[model samples]
Structure formats: structure tokens, C-alpha cells
Target: MINLNHLNYCYRSGVNVLHDITAEIEPGIHLLMGENGAGKTTLLHIMAGLRYPRTATECTIDDVSTSLRLPSVLSKVFLLTDDMVFPYPTIAEMERYHAPFYPNFDAALLAENLSEFGINPRDSINNFSLGTRKKAYLAYALALRTDILLLDEPANGLDIDSKTVLLRMLSRNITDNQTVIISTHTIWDFQNLFDGVLVLSQGRLVLAEKVWTIVKSLAFVNSLEPISNALYLTQNMGRFQAIVPNDGTLDTAIDYVLLYTALHSPQQSIITQTVKNAR
Candidate 1:
């Protein structure tokens, strides 16, 4: 488990990024959603021990404070940033140089990931395109077999086939011992894969709950006309997509996109009140 206790970050120029954000994330696939400058990347960087908060805060993964950046903590957490650069000429060389840092690095799994992604380990990584480089790094990151896997916009630069392969690999390879936290603006891409939803707004944690719990608390309804008491509504193919309070009989699967929109909409009070009562 990873814990973020009253984290507050700022830059050298004194521009505050994150507020007193606190959340306890359990083992599973977690979707971190927010707007462009909502501090998602900052939070991820702090969790990876790449950045430090201005105030003394607690960010720990399994009792080890991430701020320490010790070998034990570093080996257990892997963060794949959006803008990644590989200096190595080939995948094999990169593997040989960095594999020693991770005790559980699986060379065979790396090869398998390369094969699955249709990438040749002997090919020069510098010559690859942005999407290809992302694939290469993703394979390497997954093969590290770390307990905490943090990915930032992992599906950004990929074709349809590559995205499918990524989804397949994540669905099949994630073990119970590992926790995957994905920070992405495109939440609808893999909504069903997430076990929990975390939404941040203006540097604060606005919503955080298990997907099942959210689904149980609210209902996603589609109708030709607007619902009389919808907490949030959007247009879709001549119909209205709405979020209504679950009355214990509705079993609608939560539309994460709609939930995100509702969290940011003017009528957000309905959702906040209902969620509070449900809890």
C-alpha cells in the first residue's frame, strides 16, 4: 500500500502546485484523473522520489518513505514518465546496463514483451519513433516487476493494435502483490481495467473511491429526454447521459468519464452530497 499524508509541493519560485492532499491507495489498478495543471505529474514525481515537497510530508510505500530514495525503496517502485528518453543505442544494451539495479528484473519477460510488442531488441532505440520508444520503455518498465508501478500517459503515443497489446499485457501480467497507478487525462481509454478512481481538481483531491463503491452509489442512465433529477448530464447521440442516485436496485456500470465530468461540473453538489450519504 502507498500512503500520501498532507502532501504540499511548490517550486523554487514559490508557485504552489499541490495542497494538503491525503489519500491511502491499496493494491490494484488505480486511475488518476485531472486537468492539465491539476498536479497529477507532480504527485507521481513525489511518489517516485524524484521531487520533494516543500513541507515535511509523508509519502510511503509499504512503510518506506519515498523521500529517502534508498536502494530498497527505489528497487520496489518504477515510474514511467511521459517524456522518456533512452540514450542506449539498442534495447539489449539498455537492458544490460540497467538490469542490475532491479533485483527482480526478468530478462526472459523483457524478451517476451519485446516480442509481444513486435519490437526487435537489436534495433537502435535512437532511430525509433516516439511511439516505438514508448513501447520499448513500457516493456522494460513492466519487466522490472516492481511492487509499485506508476505510469504517466502510458497510452498516449500508440496505434490501436499497440494499445490492445498493452491492455492485454496489463490485464494478464498484474499480480496481486503489485499496485498499478496510471495518471492520464484520457480516462475512458481503459475505464474497466481500473479498480479505483481518483480525481484531482486545482491541486486538491476531489474524489477518491473504489470503482465498485462509486458504481454502487450512483447510476449511469441514458435516455432520450433529460431526467428530472440528474446530478449531471451530457449529450450523446441524440440522447442524454445522466448520473442519478442509485436506489439500491440499479446495477449500472459507472461511466468513469461521466463521473469525471460530474466532479467538475456546476451541479457537483448533488454528487458530493449523495456520495457523502452513501459512505
Candidate 2:
């Protein structure tokens, strides 16, 4: 498990990016949701030890302090940023040079992923388009089999088919021992894969709970008309989507987009209170 205790981070210009963020991320697929400039990338960097947090803060993966950036810790963690650049000309060269750092790197798995994504291993990475590069690097990241995998805006440049392939790869490859935290604005792309959800708003973590817990506390509904007693409501695709207190009745499918919208809307406090009361 990844344990974050009162984590705070500030840049050289003294602009605070993350504020008192504390969450125990268990071994599963967790969705990190936040708007632009909400510090999602910074939080991922801090967790991967690429960026340091303020003093008196604790960030650890399975009791190993990430701030130390020990080789042992580094080997177990992998961070795939949105704007990734490859040093090697080809994927094959990259594998030959960097795969050794990861003790559990799977070359066979990498080949499989590349084939699924229609990426040529021998082709120069620099020649590939943005979407192709993202696919190639994503294949490598998955094959690393790291204990902690952090991906930032992974689906940014993918087409519809590529997105489906990516989701299939993640669903099939993620092991129980691995903890994958994906920071993306496009929640609908991987809504079903989320075991837990973490929401960051204006540098603060406003919500951190398992998917099961959230569903139990609140019901996500779609109606032709607005819900009068909804904790949060919004119009979507000519229909009204709302979040109301669950009375242990029917099971409603989660509308992640609507849930995220509500969290950022003015009625956020009401929804938070309802969840808190249910908890």
C-alpha cells in the first residue's frame, strides 16, 4: 500500500501545488481526477519520488520512504508522464538499455503489448506520431510490472480503438500486487476499471474513497427532469444527471462524468455531507 501523510509540495517560486494530501492507496486501480492546474501531475511526481514534498510530510510505498529515491524503491515504481521522450532511437534499443533496471521487466509481455497496439519495435520512436509514441511508451511501462505504476493523461492522444485496446491491456495485465494510479481528465474512458477514486480540487484532496463505498453512500441517477432533492444535479446530453442519497434500493450505474462535475460544482458540500453521513 502507498501511505501519504499530510503531504505538501511547493515549487521554487513558492507556489504551493499540493496541500495536506493524505490517502492510503491500496493495491488496485485507482483513478486520480482533477481539473487542469489542480496538481494531479505534481502529486504523481511526488509519489514517484521525482519531486520532493515539504518537510514533516510522509510519503511511503509499503513502508519505504519515496523521498529517499533508493534504488530498491525506484525499481519498484514507474511514472509515465504525458509528455514522454525516449532517449533511444527505437523501442528495441530502449528495452536493451533500460529494462535491466526493472527486476521484473517482461520482454515477452512488451512484445505482446506492442503487437496489440500495432507499434513496430524496430521503428524510430522520434518518427512516430504523438499517439504512436504514447502507445509505445505505455507498452514499455506496463511490461515493467512495477509495484507502483503512475500514469498521467495516458489517453490524451489515442483514437477510439486505441483507447479500447489500452483499457483491455490494463484490465488483463494489472495484478493484485500492483497499485496503478492513473491521473486523467477523461474519466469516462476508464470508469469501469476504477476500484477507488481520488479527487483533487484547487490543490486540496476533497474526496478519497473506494468505488464500492461511494456507490453505497450515493446513488447516481439519470432523469428527464431535474431532481428536486438531489445532493448534486446537472444537465447532460439533454437529460438530467444527479447524485442523491442512496436508500438501499436499486443499484444504479455510476456516471463518473456527472460525479466529477458535481464534486467541482457549488453543491459540492451537500454531496460531501451526504457521503459523510452515510459513512
Best by TM-score: 2
Candidate 2 C-alpha lDDT tens digits along 1-279: 888899988899989988888889998999999889999999999889988876524788878889989999899999999876778999999899999999999999999999999998999988988999999999999999999999999999999999999999999999998999999988889979988889999999988888887888899988898887788877878998889889878498777777788999998888777776766
Candidate 2 deviates by what RMSD?
A: 1.4
Model 1 bad stretches (over 4 Å):
none
How many angstroms is residue 242 displaced in model 1 relative to the true structure, after the best TM-score fit?
A: 1.0
Candidate 2 has an lDDT of 0.89
Name the top lDDT candidate.
Answer: 2
Could you tell me how far off, in angstroms, the CA of residue 142 lies in candidate 2 after the best superposition? 0.2
Candidate 2 residue pairs that clash: none
Q: Which stretches of candidate 2 lie over 4 Å from their true place?
A: 277-279
